[model samples]
Target: MSDVVKPAVPPPATPARALLPLVLPALVIGLGSSLLLAAVSEAAELFKDVLWETLPDAIGIGRWSVGWIMAVLTATGIAVGLVVWKAPGHAGPDPATTGLVDAPLSPRVVPGLLLATGLALAGGVSLGPENPITAANIALAYWLGRRLVPGSSGQVWAALGAAGTVGALFGTPVAAALILTESLAAAPRPQNPAERTPSLWDQLFAPLVAAGAGGVTSKLLGVPSFGLSLPAFDGPRWPDLLAALLVAPVAAVLGLAAVYAFPYVHRAFRMLPHPVLALTLGGVVLGLLGALGGHLTLFKGLDEIGELAADPKGHSAGALVMMTVVKLAAVLVACGSGFRGGRIFPSVFAGAAFGLAVHALVPAVEPSVAVTCGVLGLLLAVTRQGWLSLFTAAVIAPGIGLLPLLCLALLPAWLLVTGRPQMQLDESGAALR
Candidate 1:
């Protein structure tokens, strides 16, 4: 959540009107950072296009092959490992150990980390673009802010930059605002009673401005939403509700299996003693999983999830189950071995696959409704953000009729997931590299 960084110079009890000036700076930083990262992301996709599509065509491989997939991922591991070894930032903080709101990193390390992340993304690594890009933007904001406003705390820029990135990535400031609320509200009161900390709204004001700007910028640039178009569900059937109540808990428990496995994998990867060896080995393992699960399990899985949603019944139940399992395993290996990315996208993919498989077995259940509930359970267990879990599920399967059923489903799922270890690392990172 939020770290309690006592501002060195106590912030004045400035009136609300006086705070309006900060919005301009926040907006500029937010838009600028998002634009910069957007370019980076586009380049990454192009690189991946060359590797996965263009290169394949040039080589005249009539179709995708397992051998080619294995070779690419393995080479990717070595390339990223080398960058980590020689790069200025050492790939920034170990992503496996870092939380969503990590301390700002030094500016010099941003480029190397950006390069490494691009390579990972292009290589079909089973990770999303959240972690490393946010880190890069934070550093960018801080470096620029120091020149523009030297007295301000670095935390301010870090928060705004992160909010901006989240907004841009999700195409909405709501996700960024909601996700950061816990951190903002949870900030511990300073030790000095005389010092008045800013109100939560005051703290959120700047971030919200940045998030709004970022969201607008992304929309203008035509970034798409993660919403899935499912079969028309006019009303929640009684059978669907019953099915959700039963299936949600199962999904929660299934996701927890990976949470339990994470730290162990983190520990094992750390034992390798070198980034080169650790990541290379991880990449090779991911290649094998890709071979097993096929192309659907590769990358961050956003596009692939859409593919499955577009044709839910195209694959058999067993195949869907294998997609979930192999993708989960790939997420663990990629994260544990130091490939920087967020857990949200991959977890959503895994959740959808699990739901599709369950729906295949229980024909009485509606596919979209079941998928939403399954996303609810999986996100609850994985991210432990209750509001976000519900919000994400409903948004993905946006039908007013589905909300009540999803809310009921969350109750049983919450119980199953509550008090369990989350898919996050402790601040100490004793078990992490």
Candidate 2:
């Protein structure tokens, strides 16, 4: 018989039972990592109460004046500078240069990073705990994974770490899944289904499991969802479209301005031989911004954003625009310096301020919708992650009605930012184009 060799069929992707080893560990790490991250935030708040409120009240500095703001931020800079320069592991890598996913730094660096983050957060730096917390969680998770599940691949660890962090940060599995799906969708695939290459579902299964676990744990722990008290979107109308068209592009332009300035500021700070000097100088500048923008602009911006939204009409359009500028400037200073924190929260805050300004100017526009669109445009340019920007806008806007408006608004925003300078530092600390 003239025989033809047959290609063997790959066993139906590994059975669910085979995923048990990964699922269990991922669940554990995800939950534990989320708790750890939450704990850090909680601790920062506690210390903030002491440093900001308790201390101020104790000494009878009931209200913070510009001089006090300057003193505190400058002091923060000195402390952060010392940590970066003399601390072991150099307070980990510069956050501006890192991506959402990267190799974990040496375990030794963890303590310094945490210390620096706590110092910044409590001292009113315009940053969030996101980057530092994610890095810490990933390093911790990976370390445990290797010892506990030696058979697991690095891909699994990366996926689980990312999912866990996203879940913890956003308090939902959907954010993590959507973000990962976008990245994984275009990855190279093996033609042979029977090969060891994992199927997409199989690859996603554990991360989703981890994400779900982290999200559930956070909910159980009573973490709050992000939201603003505002009116719902009316059915998409011509005016709505027109407003979004005008708002998003303007937001994108503002974002580009920040992106352009990011590297130069970073370079200017880096030129200082001593980390202390760089961070100290950054703090002094931030103090001035806070002084000019008012106490609302001093911190990472979540609370300030809530305040802004609580009474959108209370502040005048000029005031909102000024807040936007000051906040953006604060973000540039915090990120460019050696502060151990994130830019996302401040970026969103700045975007919201810009949106509020637009709404004030164009009374035809809906306030909440403008805020959502502004956030979407800013994030689209800042993170270069379209889905995340859209998702976050929907999440923050408080209803499904705004989704259509946000989606339409995103298109024009994307065009403006697609090839522009990104808000990231290249290897040599220059803007990535």
| Most TM-score-accurate candidate | 2
Per-residue accuracy of model 2 over 110-179 as CA lDDT, tens digit each: 8999999999998999988878878887887777677777776766776788788888788998988888
Each candidate's root-mean-square deviation in Å? 5.1, 3.7
Report the lDDT tens digits of candidate 1 across residue range 193-214: 7877876677888999998898
Worst 10 residues of 2 by lDDT: 192-201
lDDT, each prediction: 0.84, 0.84
Residue-level lDDT for 388 in candidate 2: 83
